[model samples]
Target: MGEMSDTGRLVLLGAPLGNSADASARFREVLATADVVAAEDTRRLTRLARDLDVTVPGRIISYFEGNEERRTPELVDVLAAGYLVALVTDGGMPSVSDPGYRLVRAALDAGVPVTAAPGPSAVTTALALSGLPSDRFCFEGFLPRTPAARRSRLRALAAEARTLVLFEAPHRIGAALADLAAAFGPDRPAALCRELTKTYEEVVRRPLGELARWAAEEEPRGEITLVVGGAPEVAAERPDDDTLRAAVAAREAAGLTRRDAITEVAAEFGLRRREVYTVVHA
Candidate 1:
């Protein structure tokens, strides 16, 4: 579409999660111009190009979990040769619970310039639709496959205060939700988003216990993104006015600005800045 420079670059293309219309113009340009295309599923890439009415005439290489290790070096070599290399996964962006991490790292290590052809991602899509806490959240890709390991991982994450996002296969949906409820508590709020951006798209919002029961009975089908409410913070004992004043003073004496000291003290004790400000002034 534009003049091709001799400069080599690696572009990570974000594929539409499910709906083809989500393909952006920038993404199409990168796909068409890339000299070498490394795709998680070559067939799916071809189908996507067809859907978007964009022709990908570049050399297509299959790069998935099975051959990522073997194909990584080859991709790096091509990137080193001033080739415009583009990587695409079946759905969503590459490298997030998908192939392309090793290749990206390898390309960067080889001093090859790398960038992204941004598009919609299921993580944000589901999180937004779930109506869960969006400000502070962590995407935990997918839970461990094995039962024992998955349980252990959940145990470790039980006390995480940040909202949790994760992917789950249809078959394991029931088990995963049950384990989550056990680890995070039955009453913890959560939302299960499935078949996102598709005809049968559905978002089920409920507590962990209710979701677990629903999954067990209905057995959801399609790619699932789960958003779980963060663990409630433990209530902190409110320090007396003297203690708050002394704490703020100590922080200020340790080289913090008065306002910064007050902010830190308020956050530490879970008090509002205004509350601390009034207390200090009084």
Candidate 2:
């Protein structure tokens, strides 16, 4: 039996995405035993510690996106010094559309053993509560800010048949919903979840167009996740070239280049570029 090498040990501690009670046994054990805790937000970590009634023995350091570049060496140095290092994001799993990725890479590069403390996640939470298909789904983390860029992205994903999950900010919820309605069709079935496990948690299901309208008027609040139904099953008969051309034209109007538009249309029609190009140019 041998002690785990410090140089190769990295624990990815999952924090509660919401409701504090969701913290798991493994999470508490890791927090209690790890020699160093790299937190996205030290203050939040402190609060979570208070909620869990756990006192951490090691030093807690800030390691967020803004300071990730500068903090990597420091974290890596600590791990190299033979200390058990644990990485935690403000919520949910670290490095998942969060700030723990760089440190994870650094530790792995140094041959550090990495593991996780599974806990709550808004992505899965939304999907489970979405009232949509759970068998298959994809997570499309926060869409771009610019309307044009956002629409282009949605257009690209429009053909995705599996359920789709997305994160969005409160301020941009209305615009994002509007764009989804446009790209996926106003009638697409979807759910808008807000605040998750927090006190203000809310989940609303409706057509994308109506959700957009509600978001426009109601001013949504809290951490939002949107789960949308996949594209309707297309009939065996191929949609006419005219339909494909129209879709390409719609995405083009939303700012995607002709090249990108063609790709989007081809995906939607399950056609190859050469196939779509021939139809579009015909």
Candidate 3:
């Protein structure tokens, strides 16, 4: 709380997920200089400061999911008053699947400048170690806890062509993997990153079915991030109409109904089922 600057700004500081060494110099400087530090967990922030050997001289306030709605306005007022405010979470960046979204939106709406001291992120770390296609990917965060809802969500992403990144709890990892395998097909490749940046860090890469079976045997501990490969790319040269019709006929001869045969063939070649249906009927 030294001499306050004329203009205040909301600073989103990314805290390390596990390793203290991952904390950035900019993060330390901000912690020491900011007029106020709003943390998702005040206790965790205290420990992080101690580990980094940095002292936070300003007022430290708790800002987490439970109180984010009520606390956002208060922090926004600090920013409006020309006092620098830093927001940190228990681990990684704020608002990636955590608190800080409401506060950021409020700050932007209030016309207070918002910036970030970006540091280690579980999402990117997991993706980089995933060994899957990284050029294009999407972060799905956490899936629904309930089985039906979770399966429905996975089914919705069944046709997603970009690599998918998700966060899951250790307790639900097995069930989640099972749902993923069922929705995305058992052979889909995936990587499970556990305890990223920590001493006990581990990454398990395998087909979704295998991973599901492995998780059932033993539950993994620590923060978990999942990186799943996209649906297999469709061949650039689509099969001819005769080939499509023959494929559907093969399935139909194997005991599937004509409609089901078309659906299966369409999925196999990444074509629209309706298109396959038309070709088969023609």
Tens digits of per-residue lDDT, candidate 1, 102-177, equal 9889988989998998887999999899888899999999999999999999999999999999999999989999
Q: Model 2: per-residue lDDT, tens digit, 87-157?
A: 89978888878888888888888876778888888889999999999999999998998998999999999
Weakest 10 consecutive residues of candidate 2 by summed lDDT:
1-10
| Ranking of all candidate structures by their lDDT, best first | 3, 1, 2
lDDT of 3 by residue, 1-282 (tens): 657677789999999999999999999999999989999889989998999899999999999889999999998888888999999998899999999999999999999999999999999999999999999999999999999999999999999999999999999999999999999999999999999999999999999999999999878888999999999877567899999988988988899998888889898888999888888777
Residue-pair clash count for candidate 2: 3
TM-score rank order: 3, 1, 2
lDDT of model 3 at position 35: 89
- Give the Cα error of residue 50 in candidate 3, in Å: 0.8
Give each model a TM-score. 0.83, 0.82, 0.84
Task: Tell me the deviation in Å of residue 22 in model 2.
Answer: 0.8
Q: Which ranges in model 2 have alpha carbons more than 4 Å from their true place?
A: 1-8, 238-282
Clashes of 1: 0
